[model samples]
Target: MDRKSLSLLILIVLLGLCIRLQNFGEIFDSRIYYYGYDPYYHMRLVEAIVLEGYRPSFDYYINYPYGLRIDWLPLFDYILAFPGLFLGFWASEIFAVVFPVIIGVLCIVLVYLISLEVLRNEKFALISAFIFSVCPVTVWKSLLGKADHHIWVVFLLLLSIWLVTKPGLLKLLSGIPMLLMALSWLGAPIYAALLAVSSLFQFNEKEVRIVGISNLIPVLSSIQNLFLGFSFLAIAVFLLVGSFVKRFERRFRYAIVYYLCICSVALLSAYLMPVGWLGFVKSGISYVLGTDIYLPTIREARSFQILGVISSAGYLFFVLAIPALFMLRNGFLKVFFVLSFLISILQLRFVEVLAFPVAILASYTICQILERVDYPVFRKEEEGESKRRGRKEKKKAVEIRKKDHATVIAFLLFLALPCFANSLAPVEMTMDWKEALNWMKENLEAQDYLKAYEKPDYAVLSWWDYGNWILYVAKKAVVCNNFQAGADDAAKFFTAQSEEEAMKIVEKRKVRYVVTVEELTVKPETNKTKFIPIMQIAGYSPEYMKNKEIIDFFNKTMLYKLHVENATNLTHFRLLKNFGTVKIFEVK
Candidate 1:
């Protein structure tokens, strides 16, 4: 790379870092807390690896009375624990919080490299880097203290793409990132599927062989079921056979053969194992459509709305990204981009995955427009040195060039300002919940505290959203957690109208404490006494909250009594601490 290009890359990296870390103080203050529920669980796993030397096979802190198996991949936690190994637990926790910011910046650099390789233009590559730097969804997900595996998913996927673009054996090494990606997130299958399908269009045998082999590494190591293993194996076998087939002798192209092979395998599987095949297909469809029992209640699993994309990624980039896809020339990239866009539209959980593609496409469009501009005309000069020109002509030429430069700079900034501003969101858990959980940790006599995996004496009951926070922060067991393990009971416990009905669930789950937040009970801003999510999870109709009698009945339920009435009038519950917006109640 030339010095100027290198300097510009460095500047763009710095700008990306600045935008993501602008609220560093708020996120990593004297009392360090993570931004969301999942990060806390991730740090807890890191703590286990750092302190216990390994993650426990079974966790006693969540899904109380039955505990939960620790099935999450440990690679991401191991990466987080690397810093703690050298710096100690406290410093490592801080490092874990800051790790995503570093990865976020690395993603910006990877986008630049991939864009340059695909577009073969330095200017467009740099523009792509800048767009990704300020892309709001990417920035928000990778901000300080927002430590989650989703950012690593993006980074590893981009790194894998860049690696595959290299020549010779270097392309085979793409499997390393693919392997890491499989261990980093559960959605790695989406990427593997995209690559497998896109490779069919490649006329080069070497490209097909390398991508197929790279993908097989993940499947071999991570396979857990017979059906999924068989599915991937069939695809791999076809690719291996296609690698040796002579391109000229075939009546049909390899792409056609590959397509037919997949259809044939799918049909054969459906015929041979009707029940298992139907279940697999149904589950996949339900998850993407958000039509499943649990998924519809989770915020991130809901179907995407265009307004949400505009809100998170900005209207300007979203507008340009549509046409930008058509402008992208790389076949593999176009396939991956289109698939990601479609999946995101099906489920919002994949929305952040659009960051890299949207940024590159939007940048391509912007640069294309800029390249079409007509610069100021000047007299043709000699190649080496121009003859002495009149002072008047020289001054006029200089003025015109300056005006053109200013106009280009102004136009770029105008397009970037809104996106940069949109990327400035900072997320932090409520201080009230933090203090309450801390108080429970210090004052409550909940357990023996002998071991990390030791079961607590009792469990806390709350909506599933806060279960991870209660487990990690309060150092106690919970009836439900982010995994949706005990979601049904949690929903039943909170929505039960009579003390008798609520107590039955509490007894079944051995729950001694319940947590409530303002949004669960009453929030004036939305003009609802209870949030809709709890109702949804409880299987209540949407119209239930509308009727006056139904609303009155809700006012008498266990959740309402705990938060609105302070648990004072309830027979089996007593309010222990009330932090205005957040309240904790002790079950008798």
Candidate 2:
């Protein structure tokens, strides 16, 4: 209700909006949004689901020879499909642009709530909220169409933390959101683990024993179903351990019972929900064990390093605010802050999650340090004067609080400078292929196929980046894309063979065109034999083989011809179309 708190809330909301709204058009209007192979696949599947009013069979995505069934998590695509059904595809694209911004703002508000409980200072809470709102990685992800699941994961994780720390009638309502969060992404279980741990520490002993007994009943009832039975047993163990640790007592037994009943109801409902629980269980286990996963490569390491440095700087600012942590004097807050900090550092991808906590701790530390400063007026006053000065001090404290509010605002703005810079220069926007995509749209027809020499998903010619655009704009099927984890056909296409062997593939697949860029052709000397140079682009050099016999063959052959003025670079050719950039001909 205070002026400062109201101002801070407005500031956090505005910061979230500004970061999320920037370049929203980039995602909403571009073919690139659809080009990413997974998004493309999801869009197609969602469209089918909407039209058919039924989930597609798993066989639809797993028709390759390998017989691998990829069970994709469906919550995000399903949510997207609903809007698409009402608004149609274009409006749905716009929805993707705005949805994450709304979620990001909610996340900011939740962070403030969590911080206020921990720091007990409105100013410190606002600082934490500001830090989260402007984090570059958070902002960047929120702007993209594909960011729905990631933002939901972060928001739900924070909401769960708030619920565990503050438990009330309202907090119990947090479970609805938690269920949605669990459905949102493969990473949901990690957040669940954190929540369960936090909740375990807060539970009492007698309540735990009752819950443990109740959980065991289900296990005993389903002992014949090994997996299901074991899962129930594990829940029972967790309940017992949690209850014992917190020393559960008779006074709180009813609360514990209510909590267990809610969980049991949730479990029963999950079994009957028709939400592909079995598929989720299988995929979730596979994800945890790191099977069939794609990891960041050396090129991706550069972006990670940038994100890491920015996050670490935010933590440093928080450490500088150490005095506030001590001044707040909340034992639970201290434990949560320390544990969250350690967990954030342990995982590189999670650095953004630490920003809010660090900022709050830092703000609290700063406020406490300011409060303890030795003013000359206090030191010089006599006993009577001290009493008079004490009254004056109360009035002065009000003024100082107002002035320090501005200082906190300024400090947050300083912390957000890095994020602002990053927002303007996203790693994806600066790549050369954005230009290549433009060129292809102008020159190529809907039916022309593109055979890329390099593996596109490697950031050089990332399959995810262009695959959907090719499908949407060019109406072409890519030889391969980033859906490599589950795209067995695409994976096979990449490993198949040289241009001579590719000729057979092209004929069999009825491929009409091949596209090669600088990055794809400039490989190591060892890979040269594996790839025959069909076209030379900006960054290539070809060695000439000269002999009277070879010269005679070149002159006599209809297959070989030069298409460009520059022999060393920028040549395009077709094997059959001798009029174009066709470098060689195959007698079809």
Cα-based TM-score, every candidate: 0.87, 0.64
| Predicted structure 2, TM vs. truth | 0.64
Per-residue error (Å), model 1, residue 338: 1.3
Instruction: Give the runs in model 2 whose Cα sits over 4 Å from its true position.
Output: 28-42, 50-70, 144-146, 169-171, 202-237, 248-293, 296-347, 369-398, 401-405, 423-465, 468-475, 486-588
The best candidate by lDDT is 1
Q: Rate the local accuracy (lDDT) of all candidates.
A: 0.74, 0.48
Model 1: per-residue lDDT, tens digit, 135-247?
A: 78888889888778988988888887787777777777776787777676655666666566555554367777876676676665446443344444545666666565535
Task: Give the lowest summed-lDDT range of ten residues in model 2.
Answer: 453-462
Clashes of 2: 20
Task: Candidate 1: list runs displaced more than 4 Å.
Answer: 223-235, 238-286, 289-291, 375-406, 446-452, 522-530, 543-550
Report how far residue 447 has shifted in candidate 1, in Å. 3.0
